[model samples]
Target: MSRPAGTKDVDYAQSMAILRTRFEWVMLIAFLIFLAVVPRIFSPETVDIINVMAIWVVGAHGLNLLTGYAGQISIGHAAFIGVGAYSTAVLILQLGLNHWWALLLAPIMTGLVGMVFGLPSLRLKGFYLAMATLAAQFILTTAFLFAMPGIVGGISGLTVPFPEIGGMSFRVPENLYYLLMPTAVLMTFFAKNIARSRLGRAFVAVRDNDLAAEIMGISLFGYKLRAFFVGCLFAGVAGWMRVCYDGCVRPDIYPLMDSIWYLGVIIIGGMGSTMGAIFGAIFVRLLHEMVLVASPALGSFFPPEIAGQLGSGLGLVVFGVVVALFLIFEPRGITHTWEILKGRIRHWPFVFAPG
Candidate 1:
């Protein structure tokens, strides 16, 4: 934590403060103000996109914690999310719980489910662990699709009405944006704190080397399961937001592709940092949105039959190429790139100076 000239910490509190400088505080306040007015300034469609981005940010944070910090890879995160969404629906519809209560309980239930799936980490890891989770993906999907059609809604899925208070309906994007954004921000704050805590340090230690961590008295099984529980917990929050956004829950909504994209989000945003999750979500979501917008215009240049096919697959092609390039050129992700640029700016003429 380098400080500007004439800035010196005189107390422990000031030294440990997150917003150590006045400039940082100013920027934080400005960013919050910008978020506050987004829905009022943007169109409904754009607001809807931002809402999805917020939800993805929450989910990506979870994946980052598991894969990035804990070194536990999961390609089945979307299934965990499905577990959360279905849990929420059951709590609300079958048990007669309030929507808000369902929202809280669903993620806890999902966390427990994640821990059960994570038991294999006791004996397996790396590629084998991924395969285990991949199996989890398929098994959960099957359960969602066919285990109990009457309860889970089968292919038809479950419907949830908009939450209401004081006669205000959250069915519209504009109204829902308020609910989603604050939750995103709060979750982000919570994640940032977690990353700075003892638990986060243990995760980092386990990630760096499990043998070394265990040598230092850190319990591998305890931390690994905790990582899975915490990671999937965030996925559940994202699932709850998804239900609010779409007013329904279906097996199709939580697909294998989404779980894959969540990994890409953390990879591109830079893996070990909290902000990487936010940056990655914004980048990937906006990229997909761009593909959606350009597909029709691109289709006009080709024959009708091929045009439809090209448009349908263009996003995947572009996304794959971009991720490949990022992996090759900047494997640490956008966060590292930003750090380098900031380092140069902080040193001015001595651009190569170390911070």
Candidate 2:
């Protein structure tokens, strides 16, 4: 039977969409498989780097959800993660809760806190909102520092129990890798789905034009809160995973600079793209490690004291330069560059000709 012209066009479009999606999934799966096998082929040190990269990826995805998709600027994201980490620590130390349950509930509690912070967004926008979030970072940090020996242990920090599954405690890097790898994969998957859903669309709409979104019957307040909750939930999960990875939690671990770095990750990663989150996290984290590794080599050219100082300062300078370069040259991020490359490849036979 011959289909009508409109029906045929719709079918063709749907088929192309499905093909594109399948291709993306295939590429992602292949990359993940390569990552999964890296430890087997490389040294333990390399595996450890991969593990750290995975954790950053998880945190970046959460930040991406807010700053990228939802169009919310958050400078205090590390505070949210700190909230989750400290919450988990308190639960285990003071409440005598199981580590597993603490991990599960930490994100939920953090999400609630995020919603409270997001409430300011309904009345504020742009720099004001950014300032509010900055305040959250400072206020939360101070609270953690001054909450006494009973709350967050003040300057001392809290010890995190090793993650246990049934009878197994993940003490080694390899064991922790197994636990972290799955969570990272699942978090990435969830982020991708959320970005493709009605909620994601609503977030983009709010970001693009909150007034128009409101005119279209979308509740600006509701969706903004939802974005905050979702983003903070990811932060909370990342925090829980970090505690498991580090075996302890400290207020010093999450500082104002760390929150700024999270924002930089989303910006350099391409904001709304899941692939962007992965790319940004890997690039930033690796660049950080590279600076540390190269510090000694750089130090050999200078006096030992000078070299040590240069090494300490170079990391921040390099990070700042990278962020500035991306902002000036590739504002859409590395993901957009990948898209352009793929598009050119897909249309290689149909290169445009000067008319």
Candidate with maximal lDDT: 1
Sliding window of 10 residues with minimal summed lDDT for model 2? 1-10
Clash pairs, candidate 1, are: none
- Per-candidate Cα lDDT values, in order, are 0.89, 0.85
Worst 10 residues of 1 by lDDT: 346-355
Q: With candidate 2 superimposed using the best TM-score fit, by how many Å does residue 16's alpha carbon deviate from the native?
A: 9.3
Candidate 2's TM-score reads 0.91
lDDT per residue for candidate 2 within 1-355, as digits (tens), equals 1222223324655554423355557987898898677767877777778788788888899889988998898999999889888888888888899877887899899999999998898888889999999999998888888877676888878886797888888877777788888889889989988997788899999999999999999899899999999999999988888888888888798899889888888878898999899989988898889998998898899988798799889989998999999999999898988877765555555443212
Q: Give lDDT tens digits, candidate 1, residues 120-159.
A: 9878889999999998899998899998898888988899
TM agreement with the true structure for every prediction: 0.97, 0.91
Q: After TM-score superposition, what is the CA distance of residue 41 in candidate 1 from its true location, in Å?
A: 0.8
Runs of candidate 1 exceeding 4 Å displacement: 352-355
